[model samples]
Target chain A: MVEIKNLTKRYGGNVALHGISFDIKDHEILGFLGPNGAGKSTTMNIIAGYLPSTSGTVTINGFDITEQAADAKRCIGYLPEIPPVYPDMRVEEYLTFCAGIKGIKRPDVKPQVESAMERLHITDMRRRLIRNLSKGYKQRVGFAQALLGNPKILILDEPTVGLDPAQVSEVRALIKELGKDHAVIFSSHILAEVSAVCERVVIITKGEIRAIDTIEHLERSMTANTLLNLTVEGEKDTALRILKDIRGIKEIKYLNAADGRVSCQLTLEDESVRNEIMSALMANGCNIAEMSMAKLDLEQVFLKLTAQKEKRSSLQDLLDETPDVSGEAPQDAANDTTE
Target chain B: MFALYKKELQAFFYSPFAYVLTALFMLIFSFGFITSIANMDSNTLKFSFPEFFYNNFFYFIFIIPLLTMRSFADERRGGTEVLLYSSPLSVTQIVLAKFLAIVTVFLFMIVLSLFFPIYAACTGKVIWSALICAYAGFFLWGLVCIALGMLLSSLTGNAIIAAIIGEIVMEGLLFLDQVAGSRLVDAYPHLNSVVTWFSMQRRFVYFSQGMFRLEDLVFFLSVTALVLCWNVLSIEKRRYSHA
Candidate 1:
């Protein structure tokens, strides 16, 4: 229902989005995952036709956003990061006005407003001023405003930002329900929220798309290198030596030692290495206290993906222009001599 | 667009803003009305409603910026500009809706001020033609001021700053009228013609004298339209260069 092609946004010399492209199919809830200042809101604003992209085009329901803004906007229901609400207006009055601006028919406005209020469970606060409502309720009211026109696309920019856990879940459920009929683009920095609600995710960082795939696909791909968390009741060096001699163990990172128990994270080449390491440790009088394969969750996958971009960029910079390390080498040698 | 217009009106009337501004408007008009009557010429016992509207405009100009200050600035500050921008309405439509809402409030003030003329008519003689001409001239001048005030509001997203700048600009326009009539401008015929052409007060003088020239009408309307167009452009520019 939405096709964003080569979307680039720049604020003067600073690029907010660098030719990012994505599409939202009908009845799909595409999660837009990014950390703060990752241009998530900038992309959403462009898609919603609030801020014009510096370059590229956004086509909604086959209508170009700039040329056919009215028709294109009619197909969108946007709830900005700040809710875009008038605090002085009553809930119902505000929703009705939203309906009117969205170009709903006069007679249908009342029903649409009421149904939106009902869906958000804000019917009771219909007469209350929006400023008087709590933050959660205000968010719901903003969410309810988006549902008024029953648009084909819904762009929610961190809809659950200020809500409590229960309210967040409620909003997730509502987004899930809305996904049945609309193309929803829900953005949040919370990995769990995205994993819990979205079928497919787009991970963005530093004005670039790091990875775009299903949650299962991303987690499964990241699990190629198995991480085993092992704790042994022995000398830290003895436990490390036993684990190092075993085949299929790639790398070992020491965690901490306490109460005669030494803990470390081991990267294994395969699952078969676990049995060999355990047997070898037992023969060395090292008692196994804790051992488990650490599954890579969405959080870790997100961190690795976002962090990998920075590492690759820095490595490329080193390859392109090797900085002068000769001046720092003498300082390093002097420090080593002192030590 | 009508929905936004209605909401803008509700923003004015729903709060105490419209009532307070309108009350202040009537107070100024009543003060002008009473003073004009008290200062009537003893020899002819004549009271010129046109002259009264002319004298009252200096104070009335201050209120136009107040009426228009919140039109765009409040929306921008409150983050509701996104709603308007993302809506099915175009930039021109949004600007027109807001402009018309403020114009409606201004019209309400003008209509309320008519009570003075009607009351004076009942007690004494009144010239209806001259009075209507003055009302038209005043309303037209107000339209230009309202558009300029809205442009300032949109340019500066703070209501108080918009109002202050609006007062300064309106005072500058009035000052331009004084400068146009001064001996310095009068010394140069070409400069005087250019200055007098842009002077709205000189055109309004023709209007107060009951001369409904299409030149002044077009001038006021075209200036108002120019300002409104500028307001629309300012909004679009902000969206484009949004930081």
Candidate 2:
């Protein structure tokens, strides 16, 4: 339902968004994953017609955002990174006003406002002044405002930021429920939240798209090795020697253990090694009580992709024999968890 | 537009700003009216409401800015501009609605000032037509100031800066006419006339003097329209640039 092409944005000498392109299918909840300044919010603003891209086009349901802003925006309900809320007005009045601005007719406004409140679970706080409401409530009010007019497209930027865990879960549930009928696109720095809620995920870094795929596919694509955890009730030295004898084994390391059981993690270079190791352990007469494989999760996949990109840039620096990329190493590593 | 207007109006009334402004206006009106009555001499029998209003338009110079400076400035500082920008409404509609809502509060003040005139007329006959023309002129002048202030507010998200810039612009326009009228150094006579046209007090002279010149009406209307239009365009550009 949304198509963005050649979207580029710059702030003076710094490029905020660099010729990115993507399509959000109808009724799909597309999670836009990026660290801060990755152009996630910029892309959301452009799609909502709140900002003009430097030299690109965004169309919603066949209407260009720039050329046909009203029509394009009519289909969108946007919640900016900062919740846009008027503190003086009560929650209900604010939502009603948003409904009017969204061009809901007088007769349809009440029901629409009620439904939005219901979805966000803010019906009780409807009578309280927004200034008096808590931050989580204000965020929900902003969400309710975005749901006005029942727009077919919802663009939410960091919708759950600053909310408590429960509130965050509530908003996530609402977004997931919204995905059932609308084309929902939300940006988030939290990798797990996006993976849990979005059907498809797009990872962006430095204004460029890094990868886009299903959660499992992204995990599988980025994982280079399969890690296995084994709890063998035997002497550590003997188990290590027997495991070393197995063919196709690439790497092995002692992990941890409880009581008399010994555990070690094994890395296989190929898929065939898993069955090889199983048979080898059985042949060694090792009492294997538990064996678990560790696959790359979304967080690990994200870090691996971003790290690979950073590694490529470092390789370029090494080829050029410069040390600036080396200097940026600690900073980029620090920014990952910070974002 | 109605949604924005309603929200702004409700914001004004719910906060203490409107009450403080109204109370301040009433104080000024009562003070000005009481002084005028006490100082009324028997020799000037033809004294009209127009002449009285001419002496009082400067109050709007102070009050109008105070009323309008926070309209858009507070919204930006408070992060409510996000809500407005994300909505389906056009910036033009939002700007106009905010402008009108501030004028609504100013209108209440103006109507309340009418009580002074009524009390003055109770003691002696006053020219009602001249009073109306002057009131229309004052309202239009206030409209221009509100548009200008709202435009200035959009230029900066800081409320203090918005208020300061609003005061500077409004006060600057007033002094432009004063400087132009002076014969100290006659370098640009035509430019002075144009500057005089912008002077809020000078523009009100014709209407307050019981003259309904189309030129004055068009001039005020166009100034209000241009400022409001620029406010809308600048806000939209800023929003788009940030997006």
Candidate 3:
């Protein structure tokens, strides 16, 4: 229902979004995953027609956002990072106003407002001033405002930021329910929230899209490397040396050591490498107390995808360009003695 | 658009803001009325409502910025601008709705001030034609001030700062009237003509003398429209260059 093409946003000299493109199909729940300052809100704001993109276009249900803003905006229900609520207005009064602005018929406004309040379970707080409500209730009121027009596309920017666990779950459930008929896109830095509620996730960092795939697809892709968790009762150095000697071990990271027992995580080249490591540890008299092959979950996949894009420094590039500097030889000799 | 307009009106009337401002407006008008009556000429026993409006313009100008200060600034500070921007309404519609809402409040104040003229008419002689002309002229001048005040509100995102700057700008306009009449400016015919052309008080004087010139009407309305257009453009500019 929404097609965002080559969307770029620049704030003076700084780029907030760099030609990011994505689409939301009807009845789909697309999760926008990113850390803070990752342009998640910027992208959402552009899609909602609040902020104009520096370049590119957002087409909602075939209406260009800039060319046909009124029609395009009529198809969207946006709840910004802040609730965008008037605290002085009553809950019911506020929702009715929302419905009216959404171009709902005069007679239909009351029913739409009532149904929205009912859905958010805020019917009881209808008469109360929004300022008097708690944060969670205020968020629900914002969410309820989005549901007023029954728009096909819903863009929620961190809807669960300030809510308690139960309220978060309730909002998740509401989003899941809304996804049945609407193209719902919600953003968050919380991996578990995305995994729990979203079928497909878009991982973004540093104004770039790191990965976009289903949760299962991303986790399965990362599991191909095969992570092994090994806890051995032996000298920490000896166990580490033995694990290092294994041919299939790509990388080994120490978890912890206590009471002469060392636990370490090993990234293996294949699943069969576990047997070779087990036999090699047994031959060295390092008793393997416990061993398990760990599959990379959504969190690990997210970390790997986001962390792999670390920026390269200019110093490293300079060194790579001129590798044979005579001044580096004496420094290397001095560093060896310090080590 | 109507929904937003209604909400803006509720923001004024539902709070104590409209009532307090209306009370203050009536107080100023009654004070002007009583003083004009007390200082009436003993030979003629005449009290001109037009002169009362003219003398009261300075005090009445102070309340306008207060009425318009919260129109756009509060929406921005409270993060509700997003709601308005994302709605199906255009920028022009939003600006026009807010402008009309403040104009409505100003009209309410003007209508309430009419109680003085009506009370004076019951007790003594009153000139209805000149009085109505003065009322029209005052309302037109108020339209220009209201539009200018709303423009300031849009430019500054803080209500208090918008009000302060609005007061300064209004005072500057009144000061321009003084400068236009000064001997220094009158010495140069070219500069005097330009200053008098932009001087709203001089045009208002023609209205107070019971002369409804089309030139002054068009000037007041066109200036108000120009300011309202500026308000709309500034809002759109902020959204474009929004950080």
Candidate 4:
């Protein structure tokens, strides 16, 4: 298990990671979702012990990362934003060195090296020089390097950033497999990848965490109203009148009535009212064509949350004389959480 | 620490860097050897082989920087430091491993230079005892140079900048000896005394004569350890986000 409490990092006058806190339990694969320069790498660097925090503490298992550094670092395998590899080294030589520096025992080093190469499907490219390999192959070698010693926690930053579609899926599948035992925390801008592999996600933007929840729960939180696209092959006025009789149909926009095929958007007060709207349309003389709920995907939810945060911060900037009013977003999140 | 040391050693030997550096060192040493042989008339039948190494310490001020210019600067510029920094190894271990690797390579070059004394002994009457002492002094001087280069490398992420700074500082120390006796410092006897005390070239004079003073050994070893400790501290400062 990894725990972070009120972690803060400041670079000169600029704040990179504010007083944000979160934790990952054993056997949980948590996805870190954020935009560019959204403090994803900052948080990962702090957790990996590559950088120190200005305040707060990060504890892995029972060992604090700053206090009990060696033991805390012994449990983590970190792959930084850029794969930290020696282009001059061969794949096998590099992995062997990684296992060694990761402090694996002498007798266990060879076996663990082979196991990591096999796990990442780089067994065939073992003897090749890292500089001569393609981008995808280099990435696989980086992943293989991180897998050495089989630490209990894996922190991968943008694991699938540069890869072909097939390689991307292959690495994602490997992450899923590793997550079966290791407590994996991976960050990516790709929403689909997170949805496919992560059980929960921590969404961050502007150095603050916007939300942290399972995909299902986050999807359910924005369910106060839903847009239903209704297409009918009937008279437009009859369909409009039928939709009016349905309760909780708060807003309706008639898209088109060309060729007697009318399209309309019905904003229901709640998702459960969709069946009644369909029943009313059918009870009247209307040939219903299609009805589907306009659900919010992870991408939409991320954009909405981040966009709202940006608007709030920009407003604070206008109000405050100090230009570094961007620091106010965390206070806004704190207020929202308290309420 | 052993793992880091082994990896650093492998990195040097596995690349063409080791071969290239050795060739450069041998090339410069050969120039010094030929000059010494030319200066020694044939009828004399005697030449101090290690004298060429002591005479060419100025060239080493440039050559040693090339050998250690990439120690820490390359790791930072290439972003490979993330691996060592995030690993279980301490900063002291990382710096010491790299320092040891470069020293090992320097020792290899020293071994290769032994051919000069061996060849001279075969051709003429060489002072074997003096040769032994000269070799010891040469190696200690080389260690000091390596430590200075490593410390400069840790001060910046650019290898070229590190090398340039090393060259300047090394050349400054070499020039300090000449300046100590110059007419300009005659007015300030205290400053001249201080500069003369720190001049590495004047200190090498006693070693070149096969004289081993305890103070000299302590000076060389202490300087090496002090510079290396400073190197470790400089690199360790980078582990903090804001420091």
Candidate 5:
């Protein structure tokens, strides 16, 4: 279990994390989602006891990171964005050393190392030097290192970054397996990967958390307009006109194409109109090649949340520069609610 | 800490760094040994092997950095500092383990130098008291160099920077006697004794002469302790500042 309360971190004048608080329950896999320069790594470093938070406190299983760092760190395993590895050391040797540092009993080290290597499917490369391994292999070795000592809490930053698609799937499966016993928090900018592997998602932007919820919940909360993608072998103008006549149709936009077919995006006021529009298109002369409701992917949700934050901050800047007193009250109230 | 110490000690030998350094240590010290014995043969004055090593403690100026320069710098450069920092081990333990590893390597080299003395003892009369004094002085002097090199290694993640800074500190202490002779103490007569204490070469001279006084032994030990303490403090300061 991990509890971070009002955690604030600043590098001189630049605030990396601002009074952010979050709790990770036991055995839950939480995805930390954010763009570049979004303070994800900074927060992970603070929680792992690698960097000091500017203010506030962090506790792992009731042990404070600053006051009881050794005991606190003992319960947690961290894989930094850059896999901390010694290039010259062999994979088996590196894992053995990691196990030792993590305080595995001397006699238990070999079996533990073997089990971890097996979990990451790195048993074959045990004798090979890490520097000579490929990036995907290196990442797996890094993951294997974090899996040492079987710590209760695992904090991994961008665990699937720089891996091939197959390797990413393997790592995702590995993380999912880890979630059965350990509280895993992995940070990533890859939205789909987080949705696939993490049970809960914490969306962050510009040093602050925007929302934390399940993937389905995040989609439900931000999705108001229903999008429909329709590919038809008909005149573009006739298709647009027919769709516009349908009730609940808000707007239509012609999509780019070169295949002698008209493809258009239909925005609906209500999602229930999907069936009506599909039936109407079929009845008309338009032959619908493919028709499906455009679902709001994680990428859309992420962009919406971050873009909302940018809007709020830019509006605040405008309010700050304005000499007009009338704009101050609403702006101040918005800022209060956001904080 | 033991885990770190074991890994670091093994790391030195796994790569060419430790092997090269160990071989270089033997080469340099043998040169000093052969030269000292050859000179003593000409003068007909008795010189023990350890005594000759004590007189050439300045060889640490070249050897100690090679032993310790990669301790933290290589780890930091390689991004392995993350693993060390994230582990349950305290920074003090981490630094101490690394220092001990380098000391072990230096000790191995020192043990190898013992063969030279054994050869001399078989061929001539050996002075035991002088040999004890010289070994004590050499061990403590090497300790000082190890501590100093560890401190320099902790200052940067760059191996070259660590080595350069380590060389400067060791060479600076070696040249302290020269500086004391040519400039500050020469120009300021009243400051001679105070400045002379800073010269590591002058400090080792008493032990080389077979004088194992507690004051001289304590002085070198204290310097070693002080540098180690400074290294621990530096690591702690960086931790809290970044935290």
Candidate 6:
């Protein structure tokens, strides 16, 4: 388990991460999502022991990152955004070096290097110098190096960036397979990628964590009132009245009523009320031409949550200018993210 | 520390860096050797291998920069520093490993150039003590250059800039002995004394004359230690820097 408690980082006057706290359990794959310069990399670097935190503490299993850095770092395999590699070294040689430095037994270096190359499918490139390899191959070599020590925690920053679509899916599948045993944490701007591989996500923006939850909950959280679109052949007022009369229908609005067919949008209290609304429309002499529920994907949720964070911060700034009238700051702004 | 040290050596040898530096040093030393031997009678100072070192140092000043240019600077530019920093290794280990690797390369280059003295030994009478002192003094001088170059490399991510700055600083250090004796420095006795003490040429003067002085050995070792410590400290500072 990894516990990050109120980790903060500051670069002189500019703060990169603010008191953000989160955790990853054993055998879990946590996705880190944030816009550019949103502290995603900062948090990962701190956890990977590449950078020191200004305040708070990070514990890997039971070892503090600052006091027991070597023990904690031994459990982590980090692939930075650029895929740190030496251009002059061959892939196998590089992995061997990594294995040695990671404290693998001298006799075990060769076998561990071979295993990592096999797992990353870079066995063909083992003898090739890293500089001669393509970008995709270089990235694979980097992954191979990280897997050498077989650490329990794998922290990859933008692992799939700059890869072709096929390689992206290949890496994603590999990460999912790895997730079954090791605790994996990877950050990416690609929302679908995160949704596909991650069991839980932490969305950060402007140096603060905006939301954290499972993939399923993030979509449900964004849909405050599920929007259902219906194309009906009926009079606008009669259709509105009938939909309004339904017990679970929250609101109804006609999108286009001038034509013979009227397209209307309805606010649904619950998705389970679809059958009741369909039956009510038929009984009221309304011909439902087509009906579909809007798909609020992770993309929309990410945008919505990030937008709300910005809007709330501005609101907070306005509130800061005035007296402490409410006697409390709005602390539950992200609570609705898990709705 | 051992793993990192081994990797640093491999990095130097696998590329053209190690071979090129050694070959360059040999070429310059050979040219100086032949010239000094031919002019043996013209100069009051005999064609001693130790005396030739002082003249050949001009070539080494340029060679040493190339030898140490990529120590830390290349790691930063190539982005491999991240791998080292995030590894289970400590910052001190990382710095010390690179330092030892470059110093080893330098020692090998000096040892290879021993062919000139060996050839002279076979041909005629040789000043054995002066030859040993020359080799020892040159090694110390090379180490000082390596430490200073390593320090400059750690200060920047650009290898070219590191090399340039390293050249300037080392050249300045080489001139400290002259600076101390200049008329301008006579105005400030304290500054002249301090500058002269850190002078590379001044400490090696006794060795150049085949005289072993404990104080001079202490000075060279102390300078190497101070610069190496600063190099380690500079990298440690990056641990707290903004990523």
RMSD (Å) per prediction = 7.2, 7.6, 7.8, 8.2, 9.0, 7.1
**Chain B fold agreement for model 4, TM-score:** 0.93
lDDT of each: 0.86, 0.78, 0.87, 0.81, 0.80, 0.82
Once fitted onto the true fold, the runs of candidate 4 whose alpha carbons sit more than 4 angstroms away are A222-225, A228-294, A310-339, B41-46, B241-243
Please, what are the lDDT tens digits per residue for candidate 5 over residues A33-120?
Answer: 8899889999999899888888999999899999999999999989999899888889999999999998889998999899989999
lDDT per residue as tens, model 2, B180-237: 6777524677876766666667778888888878988898899889988899888877
**Comparing to the true complex, what docking class would candidate 3 get?**
high
Ranking of all candidate structures by their TM-score, best first: 1, 3, 6, 4, 2, 5
Error of 4 at A26 (Å): 0.5
Best by TM-score: 1
DockQ values, each candidate = 0.83, 0.56, 0.81, 0.65, 0.58, 0.76
How do the residues B52-149 of candidate 3 rate in per-residue lDDT, one tens digit apiece? 87787789889988998999999999999999999999999999999999899989988888888888889987888888899999999999999999
Which lDDT tens digits does candidate 4 get at residues A71-91? 999999999888888998889
- For residues A49-105, what per-residue lDDT tens digits would candidate 6 score against the true structure? 988899989999788988999999999999999989998888988888888789889
Candidate 1 per-residue lDDT, tens place, A215-318, comes to 66654544544566778999999888888888888888898999999988777676678789888999999988877664444555566567654433222232
True contacts kept of each: 0.92, 0.68, 0.82, 0.74, 0.77, 0.76
Candidate 3 vs candidate 4, TM-score winner: 3
What class would a CAPRI assessor give candidate 5's docking?
medium
Shift in Å, residue B49, candidate 1: 1.0
Over A209-274, each residue of candidate 3 has an lDDT whose tens digit, in order, gives 776777666545545445566789999999999988889898897989999899887777877788
Off by over 4 Å in 2: A222-224, A227-297, A308-339, B45-47, B185-188
lDDT of 1 at B175: 92
Put down candidate 5 lDDT per residue, B1-243, tens digits, no spaces. Answer: 999999988988777887788788788877887787678755567776655665666775788887888887887778788889889998888988998888888888878777877787898888878777777788888898899888888878888889888888887887777787776567777688777877766767788788888888788889888999999888767765653
Q: Under CAPRI classification, how is model 4 graded?
A: medium
In model 3 chain A, the worst 10-residue window by lDDT is A330-339
Q: What TM-score does chain B alone reach in each candidate, compared with the true chain B?
A: 0.98, 0.92, 0.98, 0.93, 0.90, 0.94
Off by over 4 Å in 3: A222-225, A228-277, A280-297, A310-339
Task: Please report how far candidate 4 places residue A187 from its true position, in Å.
Answer: 0.4
